[model samples]
Target: MMPRPLLLGFLAIVVLAVLWISNPAVAFAAGLVIALWQKQVDLPHISTVSRYALQGGIVLLGFGIQASQLWTLTTQFAWIVTLYIGVVIILGLLGARLLRMAATEGQLITGGTAICGGTAVVTLAPIIGAKPAQTGAVLGIIFLLNAFALLSFPTIGQALDLNQTQFGLWAALAIHDTASVVATAQIYGDEAA
Candidate 1:
């Protein structure tokens, strides 16, 4: 039998390969399971690899978006987006204060919720002087929410009988990460994506 670390490393590679081709929610769930099962296993460079994979996915998805459609949507809904972000940030900060959370942690979570999830949190963390642990905690929270959204949004859209356009808009507005939004929309159809 292979040494335990080697076996775990091989399993990680296979799972990542599968994840690259599989549906986003399924891939996330599979990774979660593997992580739980091998909590002690340490894979070097996995974080860097995953970060690159996520960036690549985002870039590839960008290629699929029509600039005309994006411009139209942005022009039509810019005010709504601004208002939503403002309200969410205000409420998030208030709630964090009420809960007596750290200021940096609260801001990180609030930014993640009000903006682009992990991207927002990561971008703000350094500027806000967030410690590594605080940033990690906020990221973990955002990731969990993202996972939940990935699994539930498509189902909810189907149950509501949302059309491709409606479902796509809803997912874009409601989901945290771009990856999650695209994945959930893709579940509805290509047009939704």
Candidate 2:
């Protein structure tokens, strides 16, 4: 048998590879199961180091995203961005209520709009008293929507006759995470990248 660390390392790679397969965000929850089975992750006492890493990753991610480009958004597309944000806020609120979530859950969803994905959720957790489990659930839902958007949005942009710049703007403004927006923009064309 492989050494314990080697075996665990291999499993980690395989897990991440599976995650990259782009399945409708189901993989994330599935990953949680795998972690629990392997005893690799401890839900209680989730480390401060891990939390810091998450924050660091988001800040680093901003290096790739030029916030200034958001200004290039056309006057014509204002309504589109507004509608997208509105839908996210409304559905997120409704979903939280449907789940019998507290105010923190709603705050997490709102933070997702104002900032990058998991980063936003983590940051808002302390402020709103959101439990770690709820944060995980919200992150899972966002991951699902992001996966769906990444797979479908580019095609929709083409169907709508959006130029590279237009599509980039839409992706950046409409998508919940900077990573997803960047991925969508890059997939559409490097012109916007």
lDDT of 2 by residue, 111-186 (tens): 7864577678877887888888988988997778777777788889999999988787777776778666766666
For candidate 2, give the lDDT.
0.71
In terms of lDDT, the best-performing candidate is 1
TM-score of 1: 0.82
Model 1 stretches with alpha carbons more than 4 Å out: 1-21, 40-42
lDDT of 1: 0.85
Which candidate wins on TM-score? Answer: 1
Candidate 2 Cα deviation (angstroms), residue 129: 1.0
Over the stretch 40-104, how does candidate 1's per-residue lDDT look in tens digits?
Answer: 77668989988999899889988988999889878977897798889989999999999999899
